[model samples]
Target: MGRKLMSTLAVLSLILQTISAMNVICYHGTWSRYRSGNGSLKISDIDASLCTHYIYAFVGLDSSTYEVVSLDSWLDISLNGFADAVALKESNSNLKVLLAIGGWNEGSAKYSTMASNSTNRATFISSVISMLQTYSFDGFDVDWEYPARRDSTNSEDKENFALLLKELREAFDTYGFILTAAVSATPSSADISYDVPSLSTYLDSINLMEYDYFGAWDDVTGHNAPLNGQSVYFGTTYAEYNLHSSVYGWIERGADPSKLALGIPLYGRTFTLSNSSSNGVGAAVSGAGPAGPYTASAGFLGIQRDFGRVR
Candidate 1:
């Protein structure tokens, strides 16, 4: 069964690689099931034709086994979520489904540990390939969430990360499968974590997570994802946090523009007005706004629900 699957995958991978450029990439978080309110947002709810690639957000790595693991059993196994996701290709033959691994708060420890050693890296590569084969996925999207940082990561992660990508790319090439990554937009974060030139060579695309510039964490409110850094907030310029700075920084540091995809947020970040009269772009914020009726986060859905309330 393994050999048969590999053979079938190799053929499909070739077909997918030969397709035209990807215009849009949509990330579908499986956890949206619990957050969507009514019941759960199924793979069937997606309009596959809207994007050239659809990334199913997160399949985790087992810290001990260095193998792929499901974060949600109901979504991954019970509902056969991945299979349904791949089924989207039935509607738009051009759509490619890639499984993402790692996310914010998912922790960087396992990934750092796996990348820091050759034996572990190889095991992880094999595991990822097997997981893709099992799920009938088109490719893999690595989302380590800022490697080489303190807490759950080591200083060696930057170099090891490049090596990991190199190894993964070689294996992916064998099957003609796509390879991509979701990277930090913060200039300092990007600088400390990536060897952009070497890494770019192996990635089909780098999804720049340009959102979350300012949120509940900040004492001052600002755009969640600004196209340009023209806005100044509370005497602390937000110029570095905008999309232009991120894209330009990566390109200046050796990433290719053609292979870069700027991420846009479907939701908005909300903040509690510190001074109601001072509400504007750089207003003071006490903390996060109330939760949404459905999404249950102080984001777009929440703000939408209270739009007419005039807080």
Candidate 2:
């Protein structure tokens, strides 16, 4: 009886330890505040309990000064986006609000230039520290789309990117703050752009954006964020772009499994069907689906409307 009781206690303790280590990171897009007709989503709208870390999507770089610049002054500054987000901690003390820098279509030229030169890197590092201090942000999230890509990036960026992260990590450590990054999920892109093993050394977490595998850009329709690659069509190995494959690929490439967070899409990608009858995985697609009424893009809320119509 004593042995059975001890084993039961050990199992419960192990389960609790596992649960405590889990992190639920959520990206809160500031632009969501400007949804078409409806009033924008306020920081108060977020359920503090849902996420351990809330990242404010995108604060850009000043091309000349390398200082952080807000794309939306009203939301970021006047509205006190950082302060408001951090306010959630009043209710949930464990909640951490991080400022995410750069994003898709934000361009990589600035980042490449900043990372490549030591002077620029130092300036950028100081700017980040200053911003964090001013805004009371708990940490920083680097979202430099791609490092050594053909688009607005140079080959030297791969090495410089690692240097940038190392410096940033050092600065973050000085303040005892968190350092995280949003990285590409595509295996080829990840391999070329990042020094994954080195990145894991400095970063507290890597948000793996496994979504957007297929959308308006693709000629063929595919799952936006498939859990497994088994459903992929034959003859097309490209369908291996799924959550499982992406996470495993990063781990295999040397990213720490515990430090990697699989990013889940709050919005769904929409594709126009060329042949409604052939609406399955790998079906031909003409173009992007219609924009959402509120989001003005192919967002989940828009898809919800279609789902309602069918129901």
Candidate 3:
């Protein structure tokens, strides 16, 4: 047993600056507070200069209330996560601090219910405005995992989601709060989840989550964010699985190219190898690689951030 079988790879990604200037949207995960030592990335550690917009991720959606709420009262309120994050504005006057709601954990069902009803959507919108005002944030970002995806046969979510954004945009406009959404990179998910034209019209920017091309879910080990597919041997899915497809996938689907902010994962995907001798790209994997000292998640290590076209 001279050599270890498991391999951990950071998902490398590039922020394409197609335009002369670009929007570097930074999403700060408040939960990093739980990680002890240097692994802990407190709001105060954020360098506002490197980012154009600093977004505080993951405020919760009250399943029963359909209103915006803080998931962690201690971190967000008592520890001043939101306020301390907003205070970064003093360092960079141009940095727009935004509050984000919904993520993978919140799931699609509740959001579907909230957006399905006009009254509920209005209530959610009102809560959003109040929260933004209370925190003195410059904008709001909706990160519902997806819309319309919850019920594919019915296009209700698709249609209603558009209406929701339209009203949010109208309300945000009056308050001058920048509005944005964290959109999926998978083309199929986009096909079901987004009403692209409305997304283009209403959003100040769309955070394109372009990483996670591969993970422990697959039998073979692969890059978490490959620039392009490795080879023909890996099949067409592999060819289309890269970043190129993801960026253009959204653009081709009708999202404004200028509004798409390319997201890059700040962490890596880890895989434990079944055979130590076969530790190569298509090698067999037993399970997720050992968790990072900081993240502590078995199959995944993480952080997400993005950049967009600056007009």
Report every candidate's CA lDDT: 0.73, 0.72, 0.74
Which candidate, 2 or 3, has the higher lDDT?
Answer: 3
Cα misplacement distance, residue 285 of candidate 1 (Å) = 1.1
Candidate 1's C-alpha runs over 4 A off are 1-22, 36-39, 231-236, 299-311
| lDDT, residue 257, model 3 | 84
Location of the lowest summed lDDT over 10 successive residues in candidate 2: 8-17
In candidate 2 the C-alpha lDDT for residue 107 amounts to 68
Question: Which candidate tops lDDT?
Answer: 3
Model 2 alpha-carbon miss at residue 183, Å: 0.3
Backbone clashes for every candidate come to 0, 1, 0
**What are the per-residue Cα lDDT tens digits for candidate 3 across 58-169?**
7978878889999889989999988898899999999889898976666678888888888889899999999999989999989876676643234577777788999999
| TM-scores vs. true structure, each candidate | 0.88, 0.88, 0.88
- Rate residue 228 of model 3 by lDDT: 70
The candidate, 1 or 2, that scores higher on lDDT is 1
Once fitted onto the true fold, the runs of candidate 2 whose alpha carbons sit more than 4 angstroms away are 1-21, 37-39, 230-232, 298-311
Across residues 108-144, which tens digit of lDDT does each residue of candidate 2 receive? 8888888888998999989889989888889999988
Please give the TM-score that candidate 3 achieves against the real structure: 0.88
Question: For model 3, what is the error of residue 116's alpha carbon versus the real structure, in angstroms, after optimal superposition?
Answer: 0.5
